[model samples]
Target: MSSFRLITEYSLWFILPALCVAGAYSWLLYSKKGPWSPLLNKILFSVRFILIFLLCFLLIGPLLQYIKNEFEKPIFVFAIDDSESNTISTGVAKLSALKKEIEQAKKILQQEDYTVDIVTLSGKLSIDDITFKNPSTNLDYLLDKVESNYENRNLAGTILFSDGIYNQGLSPAYKELGFPLYTIGLGDTAAKKDIILKNILYNKLTYQGNSFPIVAEIQNQGFEGKDITVIIKNKGKLLDKKIITFSRNYDLKEVEFRLTSDEKGLQHYEIEVVPLEGEFTDKNNTGHAYIDVIEGKEEILLVASSPHPDIKAIKSVTDQKENYSLNIYIPGITEFKNEKYDLIIFHQIPDLQNTAAEILNKYGKDNSSIWYITGNKVNYASFNQINNALKISQRGQQLDQVTAVYNPDFNKFSLTTEEASVISKYPPVSVPFGEFKPMNNAEVILFQRLGNVQTVKPLLLFSNANDKKVAVFSGEGLWEWRLLEFKETGTTKVFDKLIGNLIQLLSSREEKRKFKVYPINSEFYSSDPVLFETEVYNDIYEKIYGQNINLTVTSEKNEKKHYSYVNTENSRFEIKGLSQGIYKYVASTILNGKKETSEGEFLIKELNIELINGTSDFDLLRTISDKNKGVFLPVTKLSSLPEILKNSSPQSIIHSNEELSEIINLKWVFFLLISLVTLEWFFRKFKGGY
Candidate 1:
């Protein structure tokens, strides 16, 4: 059962050194020899010289002998691992103890005549004469290597030392190898107390007059049922703050905030959550968002011929917002400047006898929103001359028998058979109007015929003629609703919304008088084409125009791109797919030159969402190991891994069994010696030694 293994690598140069030593010894012995000597003495001296020469050869390091007791039984391989994570806790101590245990096991195996192969499975594996580098601590890979290498040898068992964490290589099933897994876990299992801001989200851009929302998610670990505060700020001003409560155990909470733009350019803001005690990192607690607020203030010019409450009501609403600057010019006011307004409203203006029609035609040809309100005091013939779409005819007298009712229910308003078809294609809304003559070159928005009334006309209509937009209202019943049901039902909000909807429509149409261009960001380059858009609406929120509109662009630099409007429902016109840079655009309808000019500016900005730190506790690693029947050892148990592996006997198997005669060839050694001796004797006989 005991055996010695010798391993040596010698070159032909070694033979030269042996020859020199032999020559030197022979000279020293022969240099002192007498010329004549007894034959017996000579033979004795020769035998002694041969023995000395063999001893000298042994001392020259021809080969090295490693002797040890080898067990006649099968061999078992012990693999030990040393990796970075294994040093987390008592890993070093565990590894040392495991080494001692393996040594003891080896001694036991030797005494029992059982072969044992000691291998270190650190970053790699090392056997008696073979070594593998950077070998993963994964027991599966190591076992597979062993199984393959020792396929024809008798392998009694295998022992592995490692920290339970197997970060590299596939985790194989111990059952597949027909072995048991004894995993030694390492590292601390206590959850580290920490708080993290999981995520943040917000809109990239917003209009100057609009408000946007921001959302964020926060997660807490080790602290539950706790209240946390989140705060949002712009520049140095505190915008909003909220307190949120977290559920017991680790919980993820969501928070939302609203932000409104105040200027006509870029608005920057920061959102952050107040950190709790023992929070891990503050990097994730805060984030920044940027929004571009476009300038969209529209100038409206009012030209009312007669004093009326409707104009005052409309002015009151329009003038209340700084965004809408209203310039009123009633009839008989000749000193008013004509070019100062974006929209012109005509109230019961009977005629254009004082060059007013010429001025209006000029303005209309230049593209402007013109609103006409019909009344009894107006000369319909003269007004029709300027805008013939009104189709006004002379009447013998002004009739006052018509009484308008406040209809709260939108369904009660009856539409003519022809008008019903158009109304059916759109979203339904309550419309208020009086009967008027339907004219050619005009699209009717609303229609109604009073009972016993001879005249039946369009209540509302839009006309595109001579590159001009004309909007006509047949009757005035808007205030009646506010006074009657609005006051009775106390649903003032609904009434306000209705009025707001109407105003939004009229103002949006008038916005085409000037082009408004907005940049996507503050740092926008001047070479980029600005984004141009507008919202089109009717007085009653009824969408009269498609969301898709057309815009003719002209820049100070003489650049142009025809943009087709994309309808974003709710009367918004969006012109997308634009190049980056500064530009001036005139947005308008193709039928009319009415355009709103605005400067375009945009800056390219990159938004980044930070990654969540650490990992989830779903135990994905454990699941993977369990699925493969591999041992899942915590980082802390890595120290005692050797003992655990030893207990498992993971490598207990016979890789191969072969007869001793196959390994050792005694016949070959004897044959080599006989051949050398025969040659030597033949040389001596040829020299006539007899």
Candidate 2:
């Protein structure tokens, strides 16, 4: 429905002046005619008057307003599950019949003045597009798409048909849905005889020669007192095997395999359960996992003046990490090698007797990281000589007890709020009474708190001396802090975190290179995208792009595939549709007239989640229907869906829209003005008036 009205900012009285002026002009021009008769003269005068009046009236800039109302029919969505599980129990013929019934129901709804649309897992379906070929099922993703696409529209409800076997996304049960949901159940609901490898648990990373355990769960059904053999393998070589006896019809047994990490890089392991006769599909009997085994661990050296509890405290935290190997040395007591280490700790070393001058001078020149824990026994003269970043001037050999005051502005590393709070309650330790001085390059992690007064003196800080990372702890009794943390929290989490963060920050070094490329991940599923990231830098180590990088992937069968990708600083190169195997890749590029390359290995495994359990779950369908205030039925009752929707009283919505346009801008108005002027001139000429 639509309506039109003429509007103006000025009053209607303004158009009368335009009318008077036109009439006077027309009368003056035609009153004294040469050869025309009075009747013809009057007709010409009237046409001239109307045409002139319209031109003058347009000065007021009148506008034409139109209001339109549109009525939209209620929309109904019929969604179907297009996953492989739908055809597992019901063959293609039966599934095709079900699609016909759904189409008939949609036509009926359309005849009843309702807009109906059919959709599948991917999107809106064509006439013959329901093939049940999608590899996985995600009903939750389908529902989310419907809700987002039809939000605030004339959508009345949705009708879903599925077997309720979703393995990709969150369960669609009990979630708040704006529209009513009606579900049609499919697939066989009876339990079948099958053996499934349900799950596998293992570590994702370990060092070389370390033993790691993998546990696989074998779920048995309808095979009581039957023995099943489980085996694990790597690269087609058997590593271990086990036999499990199921005592009941439905039982779950766990099999464990402990294997040494012999080879470096990404390692793929496959676990399988031997199939038995009369058992359900063997597609779900095998499972796979990958572990990344690194070649070596970082070596840390701990040098001390004497055997103190602080040394034990630091060693206890470092021992928990598998990537760090620690060695303790007393300069005079034991013979030590002057080997290169990742990090060195000096605990009250550089004392009056043993300064460790030879060890410090050698490692210091090598730019190795070092941490200094100072106490009352520290020799200020020798310690201050090591680095001028921090200096202590003793006053008569006095001692002061100081607690920790955390600094929130420290950005070197991160510490949790709970860890900071726990540090505040730690017991104070003895420090030399003196005037403490720290250089401008020092970043203080913790300051000294003297009896409830926070001071500007550094208790724990980090600084760089001649390109070597250095840390200083200005007090003793770290063991006390660890004990207090465990006693209050039943664990040493806070203490361990503080020490771990410190070690990580001081030991880590950035490796900057030019023209490098590697895969983003070492392991991926067949459905997952294979992506590689690249970095091309100039001589000064600034990221540069526009270089062409060539990649070569060699499969286990010696088949090589080559691809060339243009490098972008912010994006990754994506490769698609590679089958299941272990692949070795080499990425090479030329920058600044030099050839550089990087090589790595990755594994692609197949996903069989849909075949793990093929039994139908009608109870899940009913729960979804009831939660959204709708109905659930089997596939046979699909013909009754139109009647149920019609009884629900879906209403049509009317949307009102208003449009305003200037009257002078209308095309018809311009044409009408030209026609009137032309007619008046033609009549005058025919009447013999020039």
Q: Please, what are the lDDT tens digits per residue for candidate 1 over residues 1-690?
A: 334444324453555566667567655654554433456335434544454455445444444343444334556665554543344323346545644554665676566555666454443333332222232345566667767776666664554444444545665433355333233343344455656666677765566768789888877777687778889987658999999887766788888898787776656667787877786545557766666566766777777665567676676567555567777776576356656565677766644344355556666456666777766556655666666456656455544333232222233123345333322222222223322554566765544434445234555566655555677765554455444444555543433443444444554643332223343434532223344345444444344444345556543245786867554544434344444323344544432344333444434332222123333222433543455444555544444544443454434342232333211234664465455446544544564433
**What TM-score do all the candidates reach, one by one?**
0.35, 0.70
Query: Given candidate 2, what's the lDDT at residue 476?
Result: 81
**Residues 277-301 of candidate 2: C-alpha lDDT, one tens digit per residue:** 9887787899888888998888899
Top-TM-score structure, candidate number: 2
Q: What are the RMSD figures for all models against the true structure?
A: 27.9, 7.8
Candidate 2 regions exceeding 4 Å error are: 4-66, 87-113, 117-138, 168-170, 301-321, 326-340, 345-359, 370-513, 538-548, 568-571, 590-595, 658-690
lDDT of each: 0.52, 0.86
| Candidate 1 residue 606 C-alpha distance from true site, Å | 16
Per-residue lDDT value at 147 in model 1: 70
Find the candidate with the highest lDDT and give its number.
2
